[model samples]
Target chain A: MEVSGGAPKSKVKVGIPRALHFYRYFPFWKKLLEELGAEIVLSTPTSKKIVEEGVQMGFGELCIPMKVFYGHVLHLIENHPDLDYLFVPRYVAEDKDAYFCPKFLSLPDVIRILPNVPKMLNFEVNVKEFPISQSVIELGKQLGVGQSRALESYKTAKEYFKEYQDFLRKGVPVNHALRLVQRDLPFTVPKKKSKGDIKFLLLGHGYNVCDTYINLDFQKKLRDQGIEVITIENLPESLFKVPVIVNKRLRNYWRHEEEIMQAIRYYLTKGRDEIDGVIFLISFACGPDSLISELIMRDMKVVGIPFLDIIMDEHSGEAGLLTRIESFTEMIRRKKRKLEMDAKKKVKSKIKSEV
Target chain B: MVQVSDKTDGSKAEKEAFLGIDVGSVSCKFVLIDIDGNLLTHVFLRNRGSPIDSVKDGMAKLKEAVQENEELQSYTIKACGTTGSARYLTKAIVGGDLAKTEIIAHAVATQSMYPNVRTILEIGGQDSKIIILRDGIIIDFAMNSVCAAGTGSFLDHQASRLGIAIEEFGDYAVKSNNPLSIAGRCTVFAESDMIHKQNAGHSREDIIAGLCDSLVRNYLNNITKGKDLDEPVVFQGGVSYNQGIVEAFERHLGCKVEVPKYNVLMGALGMAILVRDHYIDNETETLFRGLDVSEQEFKTSTFNCGDCPNNCEIVQVKMPSDENKVIARWGSRCGKWEVF
Candidate 1:
């Protein structure tokens, strides 16, 4: 319905490419779009065909996630021809003093290269220049809503966005979190980890790491090995408040780098006992991640914690990934077992001496 | 007194053994170890690119080796372990109690022989790994990426290009007095550097020696970079046979690199030890399909499942003798058909 008069709402079909920022910021945008009389159309979950199409269509220099994101756009264009508009947002900066990757800055331009693409409902998100509220109201106006209603929609969506984050803060899976937050449902506490279950602090970007296809079902594979995977996204936001090692070369140069840098520092020091090992997953050829992963590896090594660095690319074979992960888990198990045996020997020797 | 592996009483002297099969990218090995953890018989055979056929050949050789020893003729395999690139496939073929990764196997074998080993450099066919250990615990490890720069296959390619037998490749390295310098970053660049040295009038022996040094340099710079390597560094794997690389590593690190007795077969050896300890501790019945598995017939094929857009190529193995009973099915993202 119209806010200015009794005109009927069009129920405009807006296509959302389920990638990149989809893992983090999709909730707010989805809520904002749906409440503004537009039906949301999400691209399918990532599959091998999508990845293969992306790898073939994408340029060699682009990272794996970018290729995957491009694949999602092509998928929406080709599969859902009924889509009236494609919602490809341009992410310049989420915070002050740090910017998104250049890939994010040019996402909309890159996707528009394909022929016969839908009209883009592009939302330029640069909080430094103007508030996110302004961008939301602008996007809502594109969907044919009044400014007052758009501001209310933005406020309501902001609350839903926080609900989404709260679910993630409780260690819910990204997909489940989105579904739950949409329905306004409660998230149950995850099952308690057993005594023998190994805890692995998995570190990576939300998009690449959480995407099962990109990381080769990384979290599921870890659970298969009787391991409990804890990502930086699963931890509370307060964990990033401390003064870490803070080396200038290893500081939060990128916007999301703060989470990774801070997570490693916490695990290596105060929260060392919270996990048994660290598995860092990185996209091959990612500029910021290349440096971040090296620092993570070095920090873990210095503390003598068992660590594994899995570099994922388009052709990341499942066999190699499984082998590395299995070996790391086995190593932690044997190391703990050996320490127990040595402790038992010391007690036995002390008892013999007392006798 | 060999720690967890030799929990069995060696003095009892029972005719029982554990079997281990390692199917590598270029070769396969089968070994039998007694309860005392001593190598009873070992058969290292080039699989000729087919792991299944190689396992059959290895079994025949193992049987022949056992026939020569009167005391080992009636030995029973209490446990069996499989490892290497085709570990899961080999485990499915021969029916193994467990399938462990190569890194863990190498570390276990090295630690058993030299319990104080702080660093281990293992270079096998198609793979090379640097493992850093502290007090019998592996703290960090790095495996060669999708590159073949400093692996056994890389050296094998060069050795053939220079008209030298793979076995004699190392002897030439030791004979050369003046080894030329070559880049060790990429296989293509390393090959080009070798050609350049050859055109520049370097001796074959010197170039071969230089290749060995380049491989060692690659390992130190790429694989073991930023990691601490303490004393008692253990070097093993198929590549350890190259005394040239051994000398190169020793010279670069300024410390002695000890090659274990079963350097070429450590993966199989550690697997056997792991299987043995696990069998004894758990008291579970051995999953080995018995000695007749060598004679069993199997059919292995891969087909893409058109169930969805993923089109995953699933590997299916069946026992031909048992009315095509599906023995193992894997290589699928979603494990609906997987038995292993």
Candidate 2:
């Protein structure tokens, strides 16, 4: 395979699975690994057989994403044996503004339980507590890369990562005229507009939106109605400004909640002008979404912004949803019409007074 | 009132109805029964959006059915009962009735249908549970909701992946003789295994049948573990319609599994029957807010309840037409918000 920069082959190779947080942070890992003169091999989109082997390896009760990660690991061991070290970074939290669930924090420990594999290398990174230089040195030594080489690669990788991230931070142009702003991207994508169309913002965790069957064609129904749906996953992590004092003390804290809140706060401040309404799609038993959604919706209601809270579970119903969506949409449409009519009337009156 | 002894009389009372609502994570069912314990109207709708909206629509459908039936309108509803995940929210919406667990409702309904029901295997849209019964009483039960493979949702997901409608899953199951050994312990493994089987040149039908088999196997291993499952086993819930699963259970258990006529609505039916029995002795006002309640807006909010360290966040849904009333309260981790 031809390397991007035409660099010579490296002695050490690392395997990364393009799943879960990998979907969110592949570019960062790629640049970092390359700068450190290490070969990076990422598994393909999880195929059926790989997922099966993964399931067999990762024992009982692990979530699908974790299983997918395990599947990728199994694929690496089976297909590619040239790896010097299998690097699985141990990420607990990014900052006070960003945190991951206990599931992610314990992933390395869980993966270690699998039968047998190459030398496992893990680097713990948490900006709030750990020093980046120390973590990089530890990671380098584990991978058989000397301190000098590892330190230089770390600096280069961090710089390149920041540069690439900047591109994502600012809005990207979808076409010549339209811009796809990530910060206000709704969870649900809108249907193609004809003449007049309504738009709605859908907020929730990525897992909920990505799991289509569980959510029951939430996007399809909205598209059927020619409504534009927005979600949080579309937003760039950089565009989202962390809230002041965005720390929590809950034992079971949802890592994504703060980011969701940050994105929502940005959208509520700016999205109110661009979007017609917002809908918070929360899970039935998820404690964090319940609290965060309530807090956000309460604030929205006070501002006279129309917001709807949808709690989804395994038994989501069709007729009830249709009726509710119809009602909520009808309310929003009527309100918009009323506002337009009132504005038109005021303009006509002003024209008559000038005459 | 006919002067008769309670034991002698079948206690046939007219002009009073009972409402039973099952608010499942995947679906919501409403059943209205007359004092005679006859099923008058039933509303089964998919909970595609919100439980509150779905339940309200189900209530509206029930109202329409009642309006068309003269016998249903003649009697006032004596009581209302709810079951399932959203039972508390449903109870608050319907008001003033017994709120029972899904296990109790399922058992009660199954027992009423087949007096000799030994094992009750119920798989709904998103979750699955096995209730072992001895002499018409639940001895031990196990349920798993966090994962998808052990439930009907897994089938729905795999069906969509195969580009087959959920209704057609059973027909494909019948056609496949050489089924692949697909894993169904969790959604991830099952999905991965399905892809691998498909890639390995297995027909979709064979893979689907394999999946059906694995689902049944997982259910047996996780739910019916160490239980004395015997003859006359009954299958209930939406998953029972999947012929693949039903046949799978029969094939695995080596016995015919009986599915009742009202298997899908059995829980709702059971709750309605319970309500009828609760109000059999005395006349009481039903907590049902009438048919017009469907048109009213419900304002829902959640606040961290400062009462304890659990901070047990309480979700409050205030019904319209009441200035100083909170119709429903839920979302308490400690069951504190479940106000009857």
Candidate 3:
């Protein structure tokens, strides 16, 4: 809430629509903008009306998340006409080999053409072309901030972002970690205590999994059933550093896909004994997910791990999803019981032979 | 089967039986089974958009059947389970001991009948599903509830349009030697294609057979896509009664498709079995309100809560005996008004 840069008491308002990468990188942007003395304006959370408006504005065949993003942007534009600028970042690639999905890379361009939109403070965040620090500096320059002031604010935002990532690595949920970051509270690593129940690894895009309305409160449903769910964002950064091994003849260059694959590999290689099953959540008609899910399914089959793939869209009903999750958890629990019984029987036989 | 004694003494011993009810959008089904999982009696009725009335009528018929049979009279209902689209509403109405989705109920019943069943093709009135099993465990499944081209209701509509009874429609399909090819992607397109074939002077038998083949094709293309379907497949639900569709599945898969005697009542039977298992494992008393629930008066109403932007329409059901007391409330996103 503190406006650091001293130009005017009422700083320039920057609208940040809550969609897509908002869940992942909002803290960094918010901190940097505030440090550069800009007031942040966020759109309302996703709802039925927002989605309906988005559907009317968007053409058919776009993914639900993308449509929802458009709706959020429209909401911000319509509600906050007094906003000075909207921050729409173009994220082309995160790593050298892995590029973002086409939707993410072209999001700024897609929103630029929408009618009745306010001025946009667009900057490139591609590592190869324009690094994040450079993008932040350019964003500051657009707001008439000095280069030294922008550099200092960017360094402070980077430190906060790193702290937020550390919280995520410790298995805290993204939303909860964001609150802690906003409150400027120290991150306390959540202890991993085994409750002697089935543990499932839920893998999906940050937007799809974190958005309650989009995923139909999937995490709460699982937790209510006493099933422990660990999401891909909960995995340590070191896990993502491991190389993803697809087929020698094929390559998957999507950054999100690579992150999910690395998490799956980590669970399969080291956390197999701790985890009971894996649930791969994907949006309907997602091209990247279609291929990544097939590869993951094949790999899971080879590793002999229990897996469930749930595809969601606007038409996804909650009853069907609950049924599938119930059956899956029951199956895992039964398998775990059988394994324990077998172990007990083996010990009983050894004691009888010794006697 | 156990025989009833001739003695009419009131002190005669009573056996335990579990009741299962399936309140679907199109039909309501009821099943009664003994503690040993033996089927006692079952009833299937059309829903007609009133689940409460259908459940009451089904329960009344079930009570009459139990009273008419001497052997069934010896058994007392110990527990009740509900499944289907209206499972939650039916569970609250009947005070069910167990409630589960149709998928789990159908899978459990099929597994009980054929212990080694690896795949199950169930086509109900409004939806169709393919359940994949391995080692008596369900691992994967898919349901095509969005489309009507592959479900039983579409076939019924087509049968009515052709002025043929749904029961006899299958017989005509079986008599056809060479079935005509019809598009099966969408229901509207398929209907137009069927009419066009009729105008082209194709025999009714071949067209019906072609319609059956089209439905089977749609089912396989949509529900079973990317699935590894193994042998010992069991096809059930209301659609399984149609021999033409059964033949189409067998011919398409190049394997035998087994249809149990009580195929349409599998969901109810599965719930009965599950309730029996739950009772035995937990050693708990039954939650069944009794046969008198058929005569009870209940009311349901909905109100949209404006507490948040979600504007969730919360449903509240008033108990029959006490109109002032709301028995159940749901449909809230934040679980603020949920009471059951």
Candidate 4:
């Protein structure tokens, strides 16, 4: 939807990188920028050149997020420099006492170190602590909209943002998260659904799970297994359960660790009666995920259930992944038979002993 | 009933026993702690080349000890808990009530012994970790898995190279009044510095002491970086038993660190305690198959799934019985393994 009654759209285009936090927060940005009378340009998927350029522009030690963000910005500047500036939101906790990881807080600073990037624009949104409305208003004013006009645009854009959220949460199997943000309801996009012979759960960092281009063959391989794949977004949020032991370790973070634990717990406990097996999808170098995956393994052992830990990297080896999945599915099939046989044996033994 | 076992003082009614196994890469420790946390029998064996054989041998010794003492034979096998890297393998060998991560087991065991401990510095055979606790809750911590500069395995490697048994390493370090300089940032650098110091004619004792100092320094720099290490520190893990390292820690931090009595078998102890806690609240039969489980044969293989970009590599362990059963499955990041 195009914004109307704007004092002519700003000639300069704004660049948005379709990476990291882009999948979730981009719509708010796209709608807000458009309403503020600014044009928007989002960078494409991360590739060899993008990653290489990102590494060059940022501190050598900068984490993957910063590296990927730099690459996206570099792509925009080299390809579409007509954009007035690059928008990189520095989301800080609204309450001074509340804090984020040093990495998230320092992201904008890392971007500043890059060479020949667009004029970077940023605004802090402490979602729970700060009134998001005020932050959006101030950002609108900074983009040259009058106070009243900014407020009106912010209200209109806020409606669009809610509509966008309701759209994506529907989990229509379309690969593009951006399109989901455009409509008010779950769009009947052609989904890559397979009436699978095997059903598997996909667990991982939100960025890796939601971004299709990062993990190229995610849907196709599942379709091959006729495996019905389930992700965190598909499940009811209320069904997530956090193990009591994990609560202490997750106290500082914004329920991210809790959400992961909850997602796994929900699937394992509730889906056990429905699904065939589970597969944990994790990033190669993610720290918190490595630990969480270990915890899940132990949980599986205790419950006498079977599971798998599938780690993904930028250079994900398809051959390696295929072999692991094949074996795991085989193992699951074998275990199901064994469990059924054991149940039958118990009944036979009880009847014979009674006689 | 045969005479009650020494591990169990007829002080508690309804005789029940727990098998605790801590299988590390370098060493495998097995202990039978009674319901009251009293040590009944314990075995510490080098992991050598095979974890399966070590567990079998340990279980055999436990059987012999129980049988030899007529009174102890009355106490039945109740439940078991396994910890460490090879705990999964050990669990497969000895079917039991629960399996837990080494971290949770260690933390639980330490908390039982040092309830007031604010920080736990656990440097095990292959890895090192720092666990912080406040209000009896784990607050924040870090584990060093990638590097071996501050781990017990590195110390063992250096001791063997210097032609000294690992047992003598602590004594030699303690004897040195002036430790020679040794780089402990990495194994290669530390070995080179030790060789240089030896060629320069430094005493073995001094060099060993220097190595201990370097290990302590590396631990402080890497594992304890930016951590709020508070007082009432409890140092446990296999490395905690090394007096030389303990002394070096004292000198470095200028604080007295308390080492729990069962430092080497703390993970197993923690698992046992968790089992006891979980069982006391419920009435259920222990799934433990007794000593005969050690005689079973098991095989492991790996395969990959091409279903998604996250190609999960799954590890499967097979057990042979009248029925060939696929006993355990793991190694998918998604719930793929669980669904299977």
lDDT of 4 at A23: 60
C-alpha positional error of residue A19 in candidate 4 after TM-score superposition, expressed in Å:
2.2
* TM-score-better candidate, 2 vs 3: 3
- Candidate 3 RMSD to the correct structure: 3.4
The docking category that best describes candidate 1 is medium
Would you give me the overall lDDT of model 1? Answer: 0.83
lDDT of each structure? Answer: 0.83, 0.69, 0.84, 0.70
Residue B108 in model 1: lDDT: 81
The runs of at least 3 residues in candidate 3 whose Cα sits more than 4 Å from the true structure, single-residue gaps closed, are: A1-8, A189-196, A341-355, B1-13
2 or 3, which is superior by lDDT?
A: 3
Question: Interface RMSD (Å), each candidate?
Answer: 1.1, 21.6, 2.3, 13.7
- Tell me the interface RMSD of model 4, in angstroms: 13.7
For model 4 chain B, the run of ten residues with the poorest summed lDDT:
B1-10
Cα lDDT over the full model 3: 0.84
RMSD of each: 3.6, 22.0, 3.4, 14.1
Clashing pairs in 3: none
Which scores higher on DockQ, 1 or 2? Answer: 1
The C-alpha stretches of model 1 lying farther than 4 A from their native spots are A1-9, A181-196, A242-245, A248-251, A348-355, B1-14
Worst 10 residues of 2 chain B by lDDT: B1-10
Can you tell me the CAPRI class of model 2?
A: incorrect
Question: What lDDT tens digits, residue by residue, belong to model 3 across residues B123-150?
Answer: 9989888888887777777777467676
Which scores better on lDDT, 3 or 4? 3
Residue A106, model 1: Cα distance from true site in angstroms: 1.4
Candidate 4, position A84, lDDT: 79
Per residue, candidate 4 scores C-alpha lDDT tens digits across A1-355 of: 2478877643657788767767657777877888888877878666656767776776655555556677887888789858777887777663433444456677777776667777877667776666767777777767776777777877887787666555545654435556645443344555665467656667765566665545545655666656777666556646544333455555435344456677667655666666666667766566666777778776665554556666665556443455455445544553565567888999999999999
